[model samples]
Target: MMAGTPSRNELHEQNRLSWNEATKAHNSHKGDQAKFFREGGSTLFPEEIELLGDITGLSLVHLQCNAGQDTLSLARLGAIVTGVDISDEAIAFAQKLSQESGISANFDRADIFDWFEETATAGKQFDIAFSSYGAVCWISDLNLWAKGISNILKTGGRFVVVDFHPVAMIFDTDWSHKFSYYSRNRKCTQ
Candidate 1:
């Protein structure tokens, strides 16, 4: 580590701030999300839906669930859903959305790694653990992430991650290579 370099916890705190700001900006462009979900709209794609078929009565934990649209969708499908995110703003909005949309779900604000440890120590386990899209890229340690997931899941529980390939991170929106596939322990800022 370099002199005065941010630790992994510091980097994650930075990411939490960034995602909090991003949640506000991202929601600004999407008109009336609560109304949409209230009207039975879902953000889930067909592939993920197929992969998570028949989740009714299952307890599912959504890791890195930003604003919890998919988590609420899972709840609507009769799963007992809990969504966890590091961003407090996102979790607040998710709770509001749950109330407004009349969907029953739990939203917690905590870094996923820490939350996993706390939840696992508290003897909590889920039948399904899910994460999607940009989730893994934010993680600083895949081994910890995997172990955390394992600790929080039931013996036969399923862990599903639907995310973009690392190759996709190499290219910018213009299809030009703009970033390295590896993090190299440095914080990434947008």
Candidate 2:
């Protein structure tokens, strides 16, 4: 490591701040999420629905669940759901959404790695561990993330990640090829 280089935790803190800002911007574009959920709307895609068939009665933990639309959707399907995120703003909004929608879900504001450790130390385990689109790009260490998933899951518990293909990152928003497929730059910008 080089001197004055940000450590992993420092990088995570930076990302957390970015996400706090991003969450507010992201939610602003989605109108009346609480009302949508209350009227039985879901943010889940059809593929995820099929992959997670019959989640009823399952204990599920949603990692990096920003604003928790999907987590609340899972709860509507009868799963006991807990949503965890690094951004305080996201968790706050998720809690408010859950309350307004009358959905039963637990929202925790903590880094996913720390939350996993705490949940494991408390002997808590879940039947399903889930994360979706736009979640993995913020994860600096997939190995640690995998270990955390393992720690928080019961035997035979399923871990599901639905995300964009790695090749998708090679293209810019303008649909032009811009980045190397193997780019590992610590910082990504829009």
Global lDDT of each model? 0.89, 0.89
Candidate 2: regions farther than 4 A off:
188-190
Model 1 over residues 1-190: C-alpha lDDT tens digits?
8899887788888989989999999878888888998888989998889899899999999999999899999898889999999998899999999998999999999988889989999999999999999888778888889999999999999998899987888888999988877677346521
Report the error of model 1 at residue 111, Å.
0.9
Minimal lDDT window, size 10, model 1: 181-190
Model 2 accuracy (lDDT, Cα): 0.89
- The runs of at least 3 residues in candidate 1 whose Cα sits more than 4 Å from the true structure, single-residue gaps closed, are 185-190
The TM-score measured for candidate 2 stands at 0.95
Q: Pick the candidate with the highest lDDT.
A: 1
**Tens digit per residue, CA lDDT, model 2, 133-190:** 9888778778888999999999999998899987888888999998888756536321
